[model samples]
Target: MKRKLLGVLLALALVTGLAPTVQAKTVPAGQTVGTVLFYVTDKAGERVLVSQVPVSEMVSDLKAGKVDNTLHNYSILDRYVTTVHQEAKGFTIPEFVTYAKEKSAQAALRAMELTFAGQDAIRLWEIDQTGFDDLDTYTCDELYGVARYNYPLLYKYWDYRTQEYADPDGKLTRDQAVSEILKSAEPEVPLLSVLAFSQRYMITDGKYGTGDYNMESLWYTSGLMDSERTPRFMKPMTKEDLTGKASTAADSRYWVATLLLNMKDAPEVTALGAVGVPSAVMTEDGANYYVRFSCPTQGAAIYYNHNLISPSYTPTSRYTGDAVVIPKTNFPGGTVTMTCRAVKDGWTDAGVQTLTLTSSGAEKGWISPYKDVTAGVWSYEAVGYVTQNKIMGGTAKTDFSPNAPMTRAALALALYHMAGSPKVSSGTGFADVPSGASYASAVAWASQNGVVNGTASGGFSPEAGITREQLAAMFYRYAKNVAKTDLTVSRDLSVYTDYADAGSWAKEGLSWAVGAGLVNGTSATELSPKGPATRAQTAAMLQRLGLFVG
Candidate 1:
């Protein structure tokens, strides 16, 4: 029954053009019909045999699981036979098996050699039809066999002569071919190409499915199947690709007008002198044009919007160009400093610069409104010097309150500022001085430097009105600690009738003050030691002390 089934299956396969061909002749013992020789192209375009088994051996191998359905199935055989007939015309299939089993085995081995040589043994291979170009009667398998046999010899000679066996006609020995194949089985794909292919083709949804969104097929049809379609592999974009240059004079004019508008709107830039229309210089290298704007004065800060490019109210002395570079960032608007100098000798110009910010509002320096303190006033110079030095600030944002009584704490803070406001760890050595108080650090620093002493009650009395005598005593100590100098009372104080009434502790301070020419009496007979010192008086004393301290 198994023999009958085998016979029936073979008959069916033959009818379907799936059986291996056999030559019509006497069958040798132990050999069977069913061995076919044909050629097919491999992936690398090299010709290789479809199968290497004799028909009898193939049947036995198939039954024994030695040759699986994938390689030996009737369907595969039928397609293989049809492809060979179409590709290689006039090829015939024989009806009877012939040849000894040993000869069939040798043929199978030879076919295996052809297969290995064409596909795997040589690093490169191709058909040689140089002498057979006019031949049309030859079977495709015959032609393939001829090429296969000559490929290795030709490759070996070419490789030996050129040392480039990667080409089809290159010569190479069997060992050399095998070594080349072993070194690299396939060509390497570029990293960018692989990345592009993965990004475009390897879809997560419905992979390999045909659809409008199938990028692989779409790209293949569009002639962009490779990674050359990717941006990194393509030509790079120039600056013009991002933002175009102004082509016409009108366009340039419009840009210049817009830039001027932006500069005018910038809060930090105060245009000084005649700010003529801005201009730009275009370089040969196609760099961004360098814009220039002219200002009246040389020493002034320039700003692009709120960002300060130049800090001071002056420009560099070496800048002799008619225009300055319009300072700019990645923000809108521009700024230039506008400064005014006072005509009077004692009056301060404040050196204020107006800022016109892009996003935020404008910022200006504090302008005091104490109208009584004018340029020609007696205390004007003193107040101007102290205020300009930032040694003191007004009581209010605009009010100086020059006539207000100066307190001990206020005097300590003013002196501290004059001393550059050194860092203090803790409060003054007085029970009444709280840590959070504004003058706490100042009082602490003053006490630490022996510039001030607490009252008998072990309190700083920060809020108490500072008398002229007490002020003089503190200044004397400041001079001792900071200036490293002791005062010698060289001026005569006997002219003041009230001078003897001054406390002993303050007498020496008053004598020093008189000798230093820092103090004057209301009259020749009075030294107002107990009188409260006014803000104006304190400013005058600070102005004088500044000269002596340094």
Candidate 2:
């Protein structure tokens, strides 16, 4: 094969070096006969990907460093195959195999069968490699391109003792027949098998069938096997016997895997409910790990979210563990806080800050949202207003270090206070809370009031760190309980331009805060909700919400 390839290369070189003149020039289209490129479709006869041409355009794109084409192609092919497999349930193995293979083949074939400049040179390689096959490669004027065709055969490997499909031919067992078809249908070109199979013969055919047989199940299960294991594109599926959905697999899968791994073993739960925690960490160290910062050449905009526990991409690390990072760009200078730590542990340290944004376009007041107030009485009022008024104060000194984190206990107390500190029963002891804690009665009261529930384990980490989103959620609960009364969450703490962030969590609270002229952002777009609510800042927010009017 190597020698043949070398000889072909030499022949082509010789032709390039003027051999055509001595041989009477039989070749048409000069030396570009076999050179071809075109669009390729999926087995469903849909053109999912295309090869760019016009050498100039190709070169230009290459120089510009664009790679969207290859990525888009892979994405389309993956979706097409996955869709076919999922829809192939309840069909006979042979019928399913034939349909899937034909679709795959047609997609590749259509690409090669395209025409360009009145020339078509692509020829398909025979499976035997003995000679070229006309059926493999062809030209399509409609698509204006040429393509190489290949297809994959699908088969079932399960020993059907309980359920058996009718096999009339009697030439081969149902499993044997499917296996034989797969063995014989190997293609010489790239063949994307729609229904990927396991080595032990479990066919991934059923829809919503939880277990390892679902195509992506193997990947997810294997991803958990070895922490260091990295998956390649087409690695064969293994670890099948160990992976059929033990509990509800859907609960464990992320977005991508959930879309791919449709099975019966998946969780019956359909909706994802957001449970709020106070002071959710965004990143680790003094870097932008979870949050995204957008700075324009002249202006600045920051968009933040509390879903920073895991992200698609890791940001630059500065300190370690959920640290704030400010991106560097060409712009006017300003000062930003670099570090702010809670007096207690568990709660993440506010790592770093960027320089304060300049007073170029808009001007707003400045205040540290995470200010410490353990030292001063005036600071305590602000701290208490921020903590006790909102639903984030520690239910007890030991339950939640209001200064430490606003734990679940602290959240309940803050929420109760946010709801006018409603009174309720002090009955059955909570299995989670200690018997003699200050927040214990409040936690029980909060639960009785239908505000917050403890973990399934019946224990709430009274001293655990709280995230900003969680605090928002607590405020939300308080607002709902209080019959939509307005509470000032922030005012005069102008650090944002957008009011949307302020209105995001507790709409009623934000509305009240805004309507009462107590809470306003930096401008109209800068509502840094994810920014920590310091003792002073919280006090200011409560004052705006009408909490400490007395």
Candidate 3:
């Protein structure tokens, strides 16, 4: 029996080649082995961040039976390390070169899996530069990048947001490739995910049920809310709402939706003095354009564009150093990752954008969609007001994406809608703002009305998000010029704590906003003037603007 048991274990190792191992070394309490990020992308290229845990915590969770402990079914290239540190396996990056010199690709690959299991810098290429199926002939001297998989979505709803219902993926038990979006991540940072639905789900039959949501085929997210708060949730589709369906037992239906983190406040890069930069970087020296991401000026809410790196700014770690500056570059296949952070006061919110680039090209996707306007959310009434008044519509027919950041083009459109969607003829005159674009007339109107000035590059960043101060400036102009309201300053910016943080360009508009109560201080003293404004915040501000403009 013992011989059989040993043989079984050995065969398992030999057949599977990649088997899970128990941690042999003890981790000290509170000691961080290393930080690790785990997330995945869908076919459309939208991001679904899973978790960002220290290696120590991951080990703890794995041992505590919290995450996926599934056996490997993919190739050895996909295998990840189970441990790190010198005492553990002592495998380092240069070993790839050494191993390549010593053995075939299979043996070298196996050696890498064993040596760098849980280390951050383990990756498999689609094809090395030599055009092989795998990394058969490795070339790079150092493999100093990120690779370690701990899938949070490979299994069923072991951790869906508080629902005892069926998963949200299938209809009619059909083999239909109905798209599913099940994002139930609990990342270390605060996120405000907006769910855009094509149609609301309801249970037609058990197999063909209609419903709002679930992790089995649903997705959920959380972040920044300043209004009447309640227990946060991600609702599964059913006859009732997600908040209400938590207790109804034996739920047999499933629905499908997506998980998109709002990247409006993601750190952005641009040319230093010029208003324009190349969106895609095909060169390592940045010859295409000067791509530089500046630090958030006044705790502005920047988003996590894909974690693409600056061609010039090399980071010591995978995601710690630089970020993609332009909006997004849509090449294909090859992925470059880095971390993007947003700072508000002393608190920092981290977001991830795994911007994949290739010399070939790439595409961008951070759309959480629209129409998740649930009750008890702070933006509920504001959204209603915007939609009912026809000032702003959702990204799609059913999605009123409240948490998504208000893009510059969207804001222009909203202002245009506020102005009753007036007709204009001439082009926007900016090269980027095409003559026939939907926003062309709006930009033309805004520029003619003095409500907007094109970027330093003399272009309208139609898709770029606006800072709160910028929002204030534009709204202030609209109020003064279009709404024809009082320009009195009821309060001074000095009354706020972080008054010094406001940029010189935004000071007067921010002050006026504060004075007129169009924009309130984030706290008693701090006014987050430069932060990115969400659709919810923009709607609320528009609603408030009506109080005086009316």
lDDT of each: 0.39, 0.29, 0.39
For residues 275-321, write the lDDT of model 2, one tens digit per residue: 11112232222222222232211101111221122211111121111
TM-score for each candidate, following the candidate numbering: 0.33, 0.24, 0.34
Model 3 alpha-carbon miss at residue 50, Å: 52
Per-residue lDDT, model 1, residue 67, is 29
lDDT of 1 at 428: 78
For model 3, what is the alpha-carbon lDDT of residue 352?
Answer: 26
Q: Write the per-residue lDDT of candidate 3 for residues 1-550, one digit (tens) a residue.
A: 0011110111223423343343322212222113222222223333322222223332333334443332211000101211100001111224322322122111212132222222222222110011112322212222223221221221222111221233434331211211111233222111111111111111222322222212211211211121111101111122122223222111110110111222223212111111111122332322221122333232122223332333211111211112233323422233434323332111222332223343333322122234487655666666766776778888787787778889888888788888887777777777888887877888888888888877777788888888888899888888778877656433445645578888888787886676555686676556887788988889888866654454
Compose the digit string of candidate 1's lDDT tens values, residues 1-550.
0011110112224433332354322212211112222223333332332221223333333344432222100000111121000000010111000111112212232222222222122111101111112221223232233311101111111121222223332465544654543332211110111111211011122211222221112222333332121111111112221122111111000000000001111112111122112122211112111222222322111221111332222211111121222334522234333221111011111222233222222222223356757645667667776788888877876667789999999999998888989999866778888888988999999999988988767798999989988988888888778666434323345545678777888877776665444665655356788888999889988876765443
Ten consecutive residues with minimal summed lDDT in candidate 1? 251-260
Q: Predictions ranked by lDDT, top down?
A: 3, 1, 2
